[model samples]
Target: METLANLESFVRSAEQGGFSGAARRLGLTPAAISRNVAMLERNLGIRLFHRSTRKLTLTEDGERFLTAIRDNLEGLQAAIAEAGGERREPAGVLKVSLSPTFGTDHILPLLPDFLKSYPGIQIDWQFDNRQVDLVAEGFDAAIGGGFELSPGIVSRVLAPAHIIAVASPAYVAGRTLPLDPAGLGELDGIVMRSDRTGRIRQWMMRNAAGEEMAAAPKETIVVNDPAAMCRAALLGLGVTLIAVPDVLPHLESGALIRLVPKWYADAGPISVYYASRTLLPAKTRVFIDFVADHFKRQRLAERFAGSLG
Candidate 1:
């Protein structure tokens, strides 16, 4: 009898044409996949793959072995699933990436309920602001706005990524409220500078009536991060434009107030993205549905829509 892990690893590596892809699909490390293949090869006393620096090629024996096992692999897996009760219960580490503040503020709260519902599934959340290569990085899913829709990747939109001007109530208490975006030039601006491009970010505010105008405020304080900009505004430094999701709690708590409430800038939709496959792994599939359900139940689509103007 052959070890199931060794057999599965060999078959998956052959099908995927690389250990990395097989590892990603199996939720194992690439080194682990390679070790399993090596073990299988040693057991059979045959070199299954002609490994190279760039890619692996199937040896003659490898091709024959694949033909022998390809049709039976799924059946074997299903049999094992039945024995282990995995068919009914999804179990695995669900690796995901998301922005730090958003993940902490929104997604982290769902963990307790998620863990209770799926005890077998472990959460491995990576908080980051940069766009990551989902497939190459082997991430099960990612949540953010402005991700480039590369091939094989699909997005499930959660909310509108609309930017609205905001300021702490203390900062605006005595200051004359900007009647229009043009009047923003009169106030000190705690503006965002793009870290990647080294450029000051700017937005043309638009209202429900379709009126548009420049929103350049006096560049009093410059920061490269959204969280920092929010902090600056909270400290009564000046008003800053920000996404509604990041500042929703403060707004509700009366710590922050919406400025130029009628005007907003469309930044795009924040979406949950994952690889598009015919049969997604059980853990990944369940997680995707769970997030979508939460977003719908919370009415986040409506609450995060700053561009409703």
Candidate 2:
């Protein structure tokens, strides 16, 4: 195989019309450029140039080799330029993995703006409820709810995810509302199957005395998707423990009512994680900034629910 360095030197010499000219352009001595070209010619078993003191001429073999490799050489240059140009602007493909519910609520709605702003970029998205291997999957970033993030990845706290228990007003009709966390066992509920915890999720609550506790209602329905569970609660199927943003609209519309007041569980921060911070790609950086600004301006959990109301 032809060495890239030698091929580069040979191409430069041919384009510049002489070894000294190629050397000057490449920041190498003329002797070094000549050596590179000679090495390339010997490796390829072809005499690339017919040379004299006055002028240089390409041999037939040289012309054919140049024609074949010119495009490849130019492609290499363009790639190098793009990689180095990241400091100035965003470019290239960006892969992001996220929970389907969070992506639908927060990122998907604002995606058009991101695409419009950076027309040169492309994206690959993976939306799943299961934890994914971000690095192995080549994901530039991941957006997830809850506090614990996989080690070895960089993460940022983008927003607080509020966990609350809510049910349709019809479900509460003719029934005394659960006055205490212990009373929750008498009510029916839709629960999320937590992949991380490997069990059916229990509603988290705080009592009037400020004690945090988990309540698993005796009458419960298990489901995976938060949006689906919220919808079920709206239809008076059962109480659903969901993110505040997911149920905001129902609360306003008087369709769903918050079961616990301010004592609802605080699930901690919603985080946006990426592979590394040392050198973030342009597309990933732009999306991160956009997400941070979006949650700050709209308060994700509130705006969507407010819309329903």
Cα RMSD for candidates in order: 3.8, 14.0
Q: Per-residue lDDT for 1-309 in model 1, tens only? A: 788889989987987789998988777899999999999999899999999999988999999999999768778766665577654788888999999878888888988988889899988999988898887788989999999998778999998989989998888888899999898888889998887788999999899989999899889999877889888899999989889999999888989999889999889999999987545667888888988899999999999988664
lDDT of each: 0.88, 0.74
Quote the RMSD, in angstroms, for model 1: 3.8
CA lDDT, candidate 1, residue 57:
88
RMSD of 2: 14.0
Best by lDDT: 1
- Cα-lDDT of candidate 2: 0.74
- lDDT by residue for model 2 (1-309), tens: 776779889887887688876765455788999999999988888899999998778999999999998778867766765678756667677777888877876688887898898877787888888666665455678888653465557788876666777888889899888765566778887888876676887666765466877766654678778878988888888777677766666777888887755456666667888764344556788889988888778766444331122
Worst 10 residues of 2 by lDDT: 300-309
